[model samples]
Target: MFRNIVVGLSGGVDSAVAALLLKRKGFNVTAVFLRNWDTADETGKCLADEDYKDAEYISKKINIPLVEVNFVKEYWHEVFTYLLESYEGGYTPNPDIMCNKNIKFKKFYNFARENLKADAIATGHYARSSFGPYLEDYKPGAKVKLLHAVNQKKDQTFFLSQVSQESLQRCMFPLGEMMKTDVKKLAVEAGLGVIAQKPESMGICFIGTRTFQNFIPQYLENKPGNFINYETGEVVGQHQGIHCWTLGQGCRIAGSSEKLFVLRKDIKTNDIFVVPGTDHPALFSRILITSKPHWICEEPESLIDSWTVLNCEYRFQRNEKLCPCRVYKSSNNKLIIVSEKEKRAISPGQFVVLYLNDECLGSAPITHAGPSLHSLGEGEITSDVDDNDGLLRASTV
Candidate 1:
């Protein structure tokens, strides 16, 4: 059994219960509250102070030592800047994924080991990792296997795919095998009533309850652009900035009763193309080309050789159906994925995580996507423009 442990206390019922469980298991557990983002919302309110207070209260209730660490500078440099740059370059980047890779796992792991003298670090994330036989050598302790949580509704493997193997090997997920309902029950039983009833946070970590459009302009200079109809190449309306919209998002296009959806953005021309309907052919694609892939364990040859059939899930949410696909290698060492069924809104800058059964293999950042030859029609609009400017950076994994 692990002797010394440090758990990230996020001031939520999940982490509160996690701390309780670890203490009960006879481990010397310490709780650390990470102040990652210190920015204020549009209303000039900061949520980090409230969260820190809750974390402190929970630590006293659970009779454990609590420490506070500020990672605002690290978050701004490693995660927030990347997020703004990706939007400016016309791609929707996931900052949560970046936060997990750079701060929670990388920076926090180092702090736990060096300062706290911890043998293992844990979190309330709804994902599991365990020592298992190597994928290549079949040797014990050769690899750490990442698996979905038992509560499928709360799986977080997608956000954690980019975390380094060294961090995962010493990591513990105390709530991985339990359901959310049970976690709340345990929190209440342990006298953590305030945490058990707190609502879960949504949207960007720093933005809190503010509108995304209002918050983004603070960092990125808005470049107004023309909204063009994808079918006829006619100017339908004008947008304040391309950064305000993302592909597949519904927008109120001028002079159209039917809702319009963003199909593509041409950064070079400063134009955003829109289609009439949500089911437009231009919005769906079967082929997705991505940056270099990051495999959690060993690189699977099946992805390069043979047909390499696999199942993919773009969004990490529960109840999302997996899309069957085959992986191939492009000439430039990028991954070319062909889905058996047409996938709607295969947005660039989003992650495409691959899985075999329950084990998460790895993921890659999508760079380009288009309809398969069979799905392409004569009148359908397609963006031939190259959008690889922002994707040239190395994978953070």
Candidate 2:
């Protein structure tokens, strides 16, 4: 029932379904396909050419105009460079987060509104938006509140947290209310062609099934380094380079009987350390130093430094345990997490997201990690406890 809208048609079922939903609701809709990467060459051999074709077909079937915007140069200048820098700095940065905040929503939104004259832009992301009776009712100056999808398992609010408040107001997520199964079923019911049964892309958002290392040689000058075990302080193996691996990665530790996961990487020593086992509870950490916290609400008028209870998820584990945490600042102006529980594997460069109950509060980029403790909350502690803690055990040095 709204006016003009633009849906980011990615040639995926979710996007196709989203566009269909808008049309069914009787809203004026157009499909905008962003050409982020070039796949016509050998470099794009692994790319999904079929998906693009399907997207074009779906737009035709829906009777909506489709627009193609080439963002390959932008992707290289903005996203690819950022990704390389994060990795070179020995951090596991989430490219999807930056991609959404910088390109898809920021640049794309501007083009769609200023050039296309669209009232709003939409995507098939698995996150929800709550629009009030009127725009002013949502927030005083803000337009929308992005929330986790009803399907918690598929919720992508984590990737969307970096988006600005203004961008969120003008955004729509049509498939946010629908479950994944329902989304696919709708695609089938709509008579979408070969794409209806296409297997979902599971690798990196942009480069599917391609070894990132293969692409890294283009940007990073990899230098092979010594791999060691922290406990023994002995050279266990040699790595292709510290730049080639990330924190908590367990594969390819030299000369180890126990399966080792990467605990830390030392830039000065050019060394990488590994710990045994993937389920080592020590790999998880309750306390982590976070930086660059962004609030979706209005910027706080004054500097209010206080501790508040917030929901936290380190990764996409289904049963993400809750830990009480207090957020404070360090002498050098970084957010430090002092926790009530001994969590594990706090990785530098990974996103430490905060939540208020089910709603997203904001997030911070983890810059540093603190030492692991033996005891937490009045329990008989042992070295095994440390092993189970997952923080020190999985901590990448």
In candidate 1, what are the lDDT values of residues 290-361, reduced to their tens digit? 888888876776555533434454432224676666666544668767566667777778888877778877
Q: Kindly report the root-mean-square deviation of model 1 from the true structure over all alpha carbons.
A: 5.3
Candidate lDDT values, in order: 0.78, 0.69
Quality of model 1 by C-alpha lDDT:
0.78
User: Highest TM-score, which number?
Assistant: 1
TM-score for all predictions?
A: 0.90, 0.85
Candidate 2 residue-pair clash tally: 27
Separate clash counts for every candidate? 0, 27
Q: Mind giving the per-residue lDDT tens digits that candidate 2 earns over 1-397?
A: 3479888899988889989988987778989888777644235462545557877899998889998887888987788788888888788777777788888998889888998988888898888776621122344454466677888878888888788888788788876677888988888888884667878866465655557766566568887888777667888888777778877776854456777878788887778877667655446555577775877654333225442223243332213644556555433445556565655566777776655556665567888776543223223233432232333332332
Candidate 1 wrongly placed segments (more than 4 Å):
132-141, 304-319, 372-375, 378-397
Candidate 1 steric clashes = 0
Q: Which pairs of residues collide in candidate 1?
A: none
* The candidate that achieves the highest lDDT relative to the unseen native structure: 1
